[model samples]
Each structure stands twice: as structure tokens, then as C-alpha cells.
Target: MKMTTHQPEHYNNLQKLCRICGERRNKGRPYHSQTFETQIKEVFGVDISDDRTDVHPKYLCFNCQSQISEPSNKVKEIIPVEWKGHDDDDDCLVCDIKAVVRPESFAVPEKPAPKRRKSEIKITVVKKEAAMKLKELNEHIVCSICSGYIVDATTVTECLHSFCKSCLVKHLQTRQTCPQCKILIHETAPMQYIGTDTKLQDVINKLVPGLMESEIKRRNDFYANRGLSVPLNGNSSRPITPNTQDSEPAKFPPDDGRTWFHTNDLKMSLCIEPVKKELSIPQMPMKFIRCSMKLKVEHLTKYIKQKTLISDEIELTCNKKTLANDVTLENVWLETWKRKEAPMTLFYNKKK
Candidate 1:
């Protein structure tokens, strides 16, 4: 009785078929960059996936690769190369069968030992397409206080939530908690804890087209109207010291209406700037004002009204909170003012 031997499957795919167009790879290039694969699909209008129905041939013959690489108009002449190559070892042309081979002469070849493979990391490419609206990204870019796109973006140190610098400053005058997260920005002084969020502000500027230009114009107009120089820094809301000789005030009128400080009175140097559209005496917008600390809040108000000559009532605030008519500047200095520095800064808006 004659015995037929079975060979192991390792004999398969020692030479792979081309992955792009199924052809027996002889002088073909191995699959290298995914870019070529993408080009093949885009130019040829043929997905490489169909050719890769089986695992054997993950390479590309030079002919097909060259065809895919050439410009589309020029490449239309050659490709869609019909290479329906076979994968089975039996189909190998090297083992050609002569007519009437003797069974006894046929011997199974010894399988070579498998080589050790080095560890490798495989990377994959993922592509997803979707649509998103500008409003959806409010948490990252919009100010919770203004309910608008953030300008001069500022971030709270305590909770890390961000808002427009002016809006947050305005809100922080009355509230101690973060507008978005309700986290305690500061138990005492929130402004001290917050700083410019440069990166976030940059991103916000990019996302909103023409927003930066509009803001620049608005700020320039505010400074122009108030007879104050707009700060070169993007933080335009902060108070600036008046430029003068002998510490004389810049925005106020001549010494006639300026406060007469008593010899013993504790004077507080104040930087009173305006918010958007905040009107001053037109002639005397408050850039730098000198007042006695012992005076009541009403005295300061009357002093400003008398000096500016504006008949309409005006409102003043430090840290965005309004001052009471009866409270003294000394109390505001000792208690309400947060900065431990020379000038006590304040912001004012039209009485609303």
C-alpha cells in the first residue's frame, strides 16, 4: 500500500501576493506609507480593501504603485492593472508539474525554522466626520456673566473656570463665587487670584471672526471719550495713574474744585476709570482723583458732580460694587478695598 504524506500550512505564503492589485509579488514594493494607499483610492477610484480579501500579499508591485502615483490625467492610460494572481502554494509556478511524474520520486521538503520577530507597536489611522455649531463650545469660550464670546479672557485660580476679564471683574465686585462653576473665586479678593488667560483668549479670538477688531475699536473710543490714554496692554479696564507734575491730577479741573485735604486727614489716591459708555463731565473724565479718606461717599459724589459740571447723577464703585451714600472713604479704604498698595482703584458706570 502506498502512503500519501500531508504537508504543514507553513509552506503557504513564503512569497506574498500584492495587496493593491492581487498579483504574485516578484520585484514589488512592500506596503510602506499609508499615503500611497490613500492616493491609490483617490486617483484610481478603487479601494485597496477589495484586493486584500486574503492575508497573504500585503505588498505592491512597482507597476501598480507607479500607476497610482502619477497625475490622474496622465495615469488614465495605464492602470486598473488586471493582476488576478493566485495565493495557494500549489499555484506556485516554481513547482511545475511534468506529465506523468512517478509517485515514489516525490519527496516533501523540510520546513525551515521560523525566525524570531522583534517586538513592534502597531499604529492605526482613524477618520471621523461630524458637524458642530459655535454655540456648542460656550463652556470653553463664552463668558458666563456677559453670555457672549469672551474678550480678554481671564481665568480664576481657585476653580480654573474662565470668563471675559471685564465681565468677571464686574461680577466679582458683588459676588465672590465663580459664575460658571459657583466655586469660591476668593473668600476676600477674587481679582488677586485671577490672571490673564492668554492662551484661552487667543483661541477665543481665532474662533470668533472680526471680534478682535471690534473690541479694539470699542476700547479706543472709550479712552478717546474719557480723555485717557488707552493702555497698550489688552487689559484695558484697569485704572492708570495720571501723568502730571507735582502729583497734580490730569483729568480733573484746576485746583478750584479739587478736594482740600486737611493737615491731619488720611488722603487716599484713587484711580477712578469708566466702564463702557460711562459718562463723566465730558470736560473732566476721572482718570486720577485725590480725595480725603474721612469724607463720606456722598461728599465724593458731590465733589465729582461739582467738578465735572454734569447735571445727571453718576454712580461709583470699587471692585464693581456700588458705594452707599453714607459710607466713609476711610471705611472703604480700611475694609472694602482689597489692594495693599498706594492707589485705591475704582470703576464707575452711568447710573442704571
Candidate 2:
């Protein structure tokens, strides 16, 4: 942002108009000696006319001049030049040799522009387990007795050991003992599918695309390796059910204490009948029929051999008939009913 008077020759004009002498001059062509005095005054900033005339009178003037801080001997040995107009061919006004003035502005040092270092941006990621409620299994893990497999099975005992459905059934069929710990178990004891009606099943269903196939198979394989029966590919056991008696009709608790059955109106089916008309063409012997049918028929013929004693050719009347007439259709009936099954309870409450 700094501006420089890089034109040193022009700077001489500025330096000549120092705050010392209070008069304005035309700065036209002055005498050589007077011009040298002016140049010296401009450089030294003071009038110096009293002594020492031969140090090239141009360089000797001094009046209120500041001490030359620069070593005088070190002045660059370049020849002084004559003053000239903007013409390039003119010679120097002093030495009269083809003159060149080294611009002081060129000597002014330049500073390098500042740089911006790029910084790395880091992203931090923290892994946290999703918050989820534990869904109760509709079935037990494996048979408690032999640590064997069960299919579509869930088992829970007072000891909290679960068993596979088939395995538990088999164990109950035999000695009714926990396969794992040899504890006595009862058939009536609470032994329904344990985990169900929980959000975890929905999460599992969402996470695993083929839930019943892949996830269930994986779990079954794990149980099977532990001597447990795996559920079959087709059917699995239902979720938790409260125990109930088969002879007693199942009762549903009421809406506002009384349950009611609702019915839905059935959708009706539609049937369409077709009509026909005909017109004869003046240019041709053929007749065309315009009918409600979406298709156009050029001609229709039927051949029938009736009970004729002898062969004979017969012609039928040319009246058009519609086959869709006199049609009978019955209204379809559809019904759906809800049948309540007795709830099966996990805790039959009978001690083994």
C-alpha cells in the first residue's frame, strides 16, 4: 500500500523546493553555476556559498545543511548528466556525454507477500450402541435337560433355564427333567414362548432383510451346534400365550368392558351388455354392422347338418341378434369371521 517517489530525477525538483527559501521561482534555464548551486542546495538542504568552490561547484553548496551521514568516499562513481527535455537524443547538460541516471526507486527493496498455510480439518466420530428395550423371546433357547435342540419351541422353568420347543416336549414326554441341570420339570409349569410383543423383534426384522430365513437360521444353527433342535424352515412357534382350558370358550375383554364385532360393506361386481345395428353400402353388396363391441367383424357364418332326408341348401334370415341378452348372474357373497383361541400361559403354576 506504500506509494514511492520512484522517479529520482523528478525527486530532485521536489528536494529543490525545501522549507528553507520562501520564494517561488520559474525553474527555467538558469546559469550553469547557479544551477549547480541549486542542485547542491537541493541535495544538502541548505545554502552553501561561502567557501570551497572547486569540489565541482555543483556538489559544494551548504546552508543549514544536515551533516552528510553517508561516507563521502563511497559515492557511486557515475558521471553526472546534463538536464534535457523529454527528447531521447539530447545530450547531458553537465558532462555532455550520453547520460543515464540510475533510478533510486529501483533500489527500494520489495517484501515478499505473506502466505497462508492450509490446516487439516479432522472429524471425530464416537460409536455408541443404540438404546433399545430387550424383547422377550417367544420361545426358550434350548432344552434344559440334555442341552438338546427344539423346533419352534420356547421353554422357561422356575430355574430360569429355557429349552427348545420340541426338545422340551420330548423331555416332558420322557422323564420330564431339565436337560442341562437334571432338575425336575412339570408339563403344566409356565412354559410358553418367552420373548414377544417387544420392540426388539421389529428392530431385528428391520435390520435383517430376510428375518425368518437368515437371522432365524443363524440362531437355529447356533442352538443346533449346542445340541438343540432348530426350528423348521416353514413354521415357527407363536409368541407368548397365556395357558387356558380347551373346554371353556375363550372370552375377550370388552371395549369399555364389552367386546363387539364389526362388519364391512362388500364391494359389488359389474356386468356389461352389448347392442348392434347395421347399414348397407351403396357401392358394395356387403353390409356393415356398428355394434357396442370394441372389435369389428367382417363376416360370420355357421354350418349345421340338420335331420334332412335329402341334401338341400337352405338360407337363413338376415336379422342381427345379440347374444349378451337374457344373461343371469348371481351376486357374490363374502364373509370374514374372527375366532378366538384360548390363551396359553407360560406359568401353569404347577410345581414339578
TM-score of each: 0.35, 0.20
Those runs of model 2 whose alpha carbons end farther than 4 Å from true positions after fitting are 1-122, 126-150, 174-176, 184-352
lDDT of 2: 0.31
lDDT of 1: 0.60
lDDT per residue as tens, model 1, 107-189 = 33479977655555456779788888888887788777888898878889988888887788778766789888888876654
Model 2 clashing-pair count: 46
The candidate maximizing lDDT is 1
Report the C-alpha displacement of residue 144, candidate 2, in angstroms: 6.7
Alpha carbon lDDT of each predicted model: 0.60, 0.31
- Reference-based lDDT, residue 268, model 1: 60
